[model samples]
Target: MSLNDIDNVVEAFVKGARVASKSGFDGVQLHAAHGYLIAQFISPKSNERTDGYSSRPENALRLLKRIVSAIRSVVSKDFVVGIKINCADYTDDHDRHALVLDHFRTIAAWGEVDFIEVSGGDYEKPDFLATQTRSPRQALFSHFSRTAMDAIESLKQESTLSAPLPLILLTGGLRTPELLHTALAARHAHLLGIGRTSILCPDLPRLLKEMEKETREVGTASSEAYWSSPFRPEPDLTFSPIIRNLVPTIPLVGAGIGTAWYVVTFRRLAAPPTSKGMSFEPDYNLGPLGAVFWMWIWVDTRPTSGMKVCRRRLSPIGIVTAAFHARWPKSPLCKTLMEYERQILGLKLEAGSLGLKETLAGREVYTHVGWLALVSGAGISASTTYIGIVRSGLPALIHERVTSTPADWNAFLTMVRDININDIREGAAELRAASQRERLMEERIQAMEVQCGIRAAPRDLYY
Candidate 1:
């Protein structure tokens, strides 16, 4: 963003805080997790700016700090201000977890924040929030939260800040009350939060409270007997494997689907119940696929109250185009190419046709084919700025291998690690060429105008 844009954003945050405070909100938590704008600025890979908000560790947090300071200045001291931050990006980098903890220490030491919610991963790594697997990892982010809490304690002991140390709220894959109770008892976090669990069981807190009373009557440990309760209902955050495989192939799609699923579900829950005594219950009838379709329809047909007639007519197209910046994962041509490749190679992998082979050579060959299909057949516009390239068949390979045999699992790992550099470089070149070729057209037009001794004509000039 330009300096002006950054300033505007900070002003907007302060204004929002002011409004919230006046509107009787007790606190406002800055959502800096899950790769949102603040999170993006925090991430080293994403923030490439050089003017104050640069990727330099010290400067990277400039924007967030400015907003926090601005908000603090505007709001009353009694009003609380909290922040939700990622533990790590959940990439291959082992040091990133430690780095994020260090960042959190800086945030905590500022003495401006009231509470801290420790969450990890972004849309690309949605498994941290919720997973498609039958058994999701328990307390996915508790270790990070624990480490952060230790840092906060050390900061409190060394520093002379009068402001109370921030309370840590760890949230992720926390299904059962037992897990919540265990985390609090161990002091891993000051408070606990749930995601998928809350969606499935909105009355989970009440249910657990009543269960706690029952456990005390029997003289049984609440945590120990919590699992045996008949009321425990598994949260179904799973989408079809095919949808999962397809989404990751398209940029930002994995994130969009996760958000859209919740939005659609919440809308369903908010409506007055059709049957008696079904108020506030989850609408189990809406499956993942149904939710996504309904989300699309709802967004497409939403009331365009102050929009112009032309804009209203074109709004649906704009929505799809905005969501899928350049590449269309649902392109028939791309699907046809993948299907054709699968048929010709006599390979049929579940959840979208492509799979990993036991041999390194086969994997390399498949990767090359997958790259061409995605780049050429996806109809990626040349004018679009290239953000990142998708590792063509990896998502499908991983999805298929999820339930595969041990040998296949080992082969999947091998295929991932044993990539031929030449094949990858060639695939990258293909994607690069597609982007450059599109930009080249505009460049040529400017060159022609220069040669003709004329200024480039704006579209409005011709119109």
Candidate 2:
């Protein structure tokens, strides 16, 4: 960034800290980790600038130092200011790694900072996501955290400040309570951080408290006692091994896809309760394909509300059909479209009707029309006329071919046994034939109208 840009950037951080304090936050942590903008400037692998920010290692930290000072000027002493820096970027070079650690020690020496949260890796080597399972024999990031603590301790002894040393927070691979307790006890890190595990078990702290009570009653104290207590963390899902093997592993596809899965889950958890009901449950069953689909398509992510028929946008032909139907409701085209819509809706209601009926047999079936926007307003006739085409006629055709014996999710192959390529081909052929016949009839009618003087002939024909 230019000199002017740097000034604006620092000012923005100061403003953010000010707002955070005023808004009743405990502290603001500057994210100079995980290949972000500030982290980019700190990493020699990425930063190629000849500016003051990149001239030397100390100068590389100049941006963060400026922000810390600016924040201190605005917020109270009680308002904690922490910086999350990389333990080291993914590099094999010892000198480069040492330089990165030195940058961390330098920040710790600065008295204004309250805490330093150490996290490693970036988009290139995203061990930061911690989605992959590491070998139980070797702990993740334990060595790095220990070395970082030693560096901090060395800085504290050299400094003349009488205040306590800044706390070190180690994040990544702190899944089990056993590992967390061990990390703290060993002084590997003063604090610990959790990520994906928290999403899987939101009430983990409460669960742990309950386990501690049970274990105490059993006269057991070891962390392993809780392992048999019926409260184990759910295995976090990711791409299948087949997919992993298919892609080049160096730029790990699982890391990116796994992150997307977590992101989609976050959105689901944050969404407010709809008119039908709230779907607070995390979709753990969501596969890699569904993850990409939901991430890109907004409408698909929207939870299927009540058992009502949902409609989608009408195609160009569908709009014309609707208009023609509205003008002549008794016409063959109008009648045929109406019949198609009714048949499709019947199929939908039948397919999803069983499970709900068995559970809520007597209760009224509440229909939800989520796609009302497309099927309403001044063009209501045009929209409603093509209701059969909701998300394509493929769904209706598939439903027709499949058995009406209610869905058996366990026997997924059985449920889709009848929906073969032949059925799909037949459906497409029928649709094409119908569209061609309709177009020809429409042209013939227009010509007949002009000859009978029911409609004026084109003046250009005589010219």
Q: What are the models' TM-scores?
A: 0.58, 0.58
Tens-digit lDDT string for candidate 2 (49-128): 88888827768888889999999997888999998877657346787668867876777767888888877778887667
Residues forming the 10-long window of minimal summed lDDT in candidate 1? 382-391
lDDT (Cα) of model 1: 0.62
Q: How close is candidate 2 to the true structure, as a TM-score?
A: 0.58
CA shift of 167, model 2, Å: 0.7
Q: Model 1 Cα RMSD, Å?
A: 27.6
After superposition, the stretches of candidate 1 with alpha carbons farther than 4 Å from their true spots are 90-95, 132-140, 219-225, 228-232, 235-261, 275-279, 298-463
Pairs in steric clash, model 1: none
Error of 2 at 110 (Å): 1.1
Give the candidate number with the greatest lDDT: 2
TM-score of 1: 0.58
- Give the Å shift of residue 98 in candidate 2: 3.0
Clashes of 2: 0
Give the C-alpha miss distance for residue 208 in model 1, angstroms: 2.0
